[model samples]
Target: MSQHIALLGSTGSIGTQVLDVVRHWPGRFTIAALGAGKNLERLAQQTGEFHPRCIAIQQESDLPALRELLNVHAPAFSGEILVGKAGLNAIAESSVSALVIVGLVGLAGLEPTLKALYAGKRVLTANKETFVTGGHLVQPYLDRVIPIDSEHAAIHQCLKNEPVKAVKHILLTASGGPFRTFSAADMQKVTLSQALKHPNWVMGHKITIDSATMMNKGLEVIEAHWLFGVSYDQIQVVVHPESMIHSGVEFVDGSILLQMGAPDMRGPIQYAMTYPERLPNPEPKVHLDFLSLSRLNLEPPDLERFPCIRLAYEAGRLGSGATAVLNGADEMAVQLFLEEQIDYCAIPKLLEAALNAHRQESTPSAPSLSDIHALDDWARRFVREQANPLTARSTG
Candidate 1:
């Protein structure tokens, strides 16, 4: 029987690629539901193609606009159209599908993921922030929430049903962004365009910028900690420019297992979508000749250059609301940098200030999903208000 899937963030980078995977294997899977942000044009197009049983939009006010678009593009899609969190939960908890993919970016992904877990659905997700902020809530269902990110997926494959104690440590590989070779002086004058130009992978703007600053790897480190039950110290980050050896695990026996593939998100997406099975890729297959010619390299990340990474380790070690604040701050900082409201270097400084302020909060309460959201909001505001001074520091 074909598996039914509920897809969140169906219009974004990973979402679109996931749709491609479904399109590739029409015999193995069917789209039961879909969710998107405000991209009604793309949503309408997807609805026209997949005709999901139900659809949800992030912006409720855009419902009329979406309805109009669907009338033209998907005149036949009479499935339910829900709005906001209510709609998100409706599809997340929908009984028609047992598999849910949560790709919604940032804090927006947390609630719906929790809803799906509550509904006992097997979730495969790219939303690192969901685990970054509310990992404890999702911890109870660790077996059900599989990772779709390449690094985590690679680690998942390497473990291969082995006990956690059997592992020595996991190495989370990074492309080191476009700024890997750049010095502090070079970063000081960096612009939005340079940061967005990732050396290898093409991704959404926020992630591309996060990659430039290595904050994406840091967030992945936190996610790996939750996903693999490893300490921050046990999970290592090695800068691999080739991105061929996606990631690896070194067991206590000294034998390392590495999952290698093309630098394509679709590979990992398909892996999570079809667990315990491999798909015959239609196009863009990895060429052994091309890979054989490329030389792989690894190096330690420079803390002096990428302070966001340092903040991530500190936040993760702090063990409560700190990681949540760190994620929220980076999300807002990346937006500010993208808009040119702050220099590329100020991204780290802005994150530092937000983390500092969050530490001084009148009371650091116990971990709660709601508190994580509140901390996320507070961190965004804190960073925005402090942007001017940090930008001054960057240009000074």
Candidate 2:
């Protein structure tokens, strides 16, 4: 049976790749609904080609132009909708869609994710901040929460069919970004362009910078804890510069299971979209011979150099508003760094201050959706205050 899909963030890196998967296996899947940010032209083209039952755009003003464009060509597409809280709700609750692919960046993806889960749709997620910021709100509603990020996908595949108690530890691998060897003093001079130049993967700008500071790995650590029901200590981050071994899981029997593949998002994307069954696609295959598959190297991530990863583990262990604070603070810090308001090295420093200021809740309970929003607002305000002492004093 063909699986119908509602794809949020339809113009993003993961969304576009999802389209590729749909194109290759036309008979196996259907694009029932689609949504995107302000990329109207791409949205228009996607609507024109795929002819989804419904479409949503982030900017309300773009709706008229989009509707007109669809009217002229795909007039049967009378189902297009203006993307907002209601639009997200409609797409998540659509009866035809069995699963929702949420590739949206940052906290913007959080609400829709919860909506989908509550509506009883399986969620194939790439938005780390959703789990980082509000998994407590979404986890109980989930029947299946699949990972779309390669590392998490690798860990997911590795741990399949194994009892949670039998697992020793989950080893999440990172490529060490573009500055693996740079000293703390050297990071102070790094530019936005330098941080965006990721060595192993081509990803969105915010995530590229996060990788440089190891904040992406930090977010993933929290995500793994939520997704796998593992303790913070049970999850490990290893600096695997080769980028070949996606992730590994060591069991209680001392046997290690590893998932290795070329650094391609499509592999995992396809896996999640067609779970319990693998579909054949013409995407590039991993050729071990041409790349010279030598021995895999792994080492402990340096907490002194990549303190963001350390901060994430601390937040995950604390388990309250901590992950929410870490995510919100890092989001603000990344924006500030990109805008040249702060140096790359200062990103972790700002995140640490925000996390430290937060008082861990005693007898922590799962946060409500409102609580997640409040924590995000508080964390952003705290980070901005630290970034500008004048603002801090005025508020004080």
Candidate 3:
């Protein structure tokens, strides 16, 4: 049976990979709707090909330009073009699509995700921030969320109808980033270009940097807690420099189930789309010879070397809107660093400060949709106010 898919963030790395899946297995899935931010040109191209019933863009000002582009190239396309937050929410609640594939960055995906879940759509998401900040609130409505992140997806596959209690813990693996062997002093002198080069998977600039800081793993920890209903202590991050062994789940009997594959996003993306029924791999099948590669090294994450991971654990333990603050501040800090306004090492410093401030101000409980989003705003503002000009700071 063919399924309708709402391809949110259709122009992004994850979104494009999803399109690749759709393109390869066009009979299995059809594009019902699409959403993107500030990339109208690419959106227009996608619209021309997929011809979704409706589409969404981030800014209201982007609407006219998108319309003009669509008119010139995709003249026969009859879908409604919507704009801004309300538009995104509207698309999510449209019910025209049974599956909403969220690839948008940050907390921008929160409201739309809830809307889709409430609308009874199976949401497949690569948006980790949505889970990180809104997990406490979104859990009740989520029945079938496909984790598109390779590690989480691996864990999900490993679980496969198994009893949750039978599982001992989840081992989330990391690529150890580009500067895996670099000293703290060396990291401080790192440039944006160097930090963005992920040694394993090809990803967006923000996520690549997050991996470098191990903050991506940090955020993933929070996501895992919510996704699997596991405690912080049950989730562990290990450095897997080779990028094989996406993740593993250890059972109570000490038997560990591992999901090994080449570092390919499409593998997980297609896994989520086709669901319980496995789809044949569409990406370039990377050959991995375990015998020749020698041993796979697993080591505990160095919290002293990478403080963001510790900060993530701390914020998660603090509960409430603390994770929201960490994400908000990190976004600001990452943007600043990308723009050459801040040093690489300052990312976690700024995030830690913001987390501390949010902990002081927020209640020790899960926040509502509006409350979390409001806290997201407040956190961004706090990071901006705390910016130190001489050193790296939030908001370029």
User: Which candidate number maximizes lDDT?
Assistant: 1
TM-score of each: 0.95, 0.93, 0.96
Off by over 4 Å in 2: 68-76, 360-365, 389-396
Q: Which regions in candidate 1 have their CA more than 4 angstroms from the true location?
A: 288-291, 362-366, 388-396
> How large is the C-alpha RMSD of every model relative to the true structure?
3.1, 2.4, 2.1
TM-score of 2: 0.93
User: What value does the lDDT take at residue 357 in candidate 1?
Assistant: 78
Candidate 2 residue pairs in backbone clash: none
TM-score of 3: 0.96
What ranking emerges by lDDT with the best candidate at the front?
1, 3, 2
Rank by TM-score (best first): 3, 1, 2
Candidate 1 or 3, higher lDDT? 1
lDDT of 1 by residue, 66-136 (tens): 99999999999999999998889889999979999988999889898998999999999999988888887
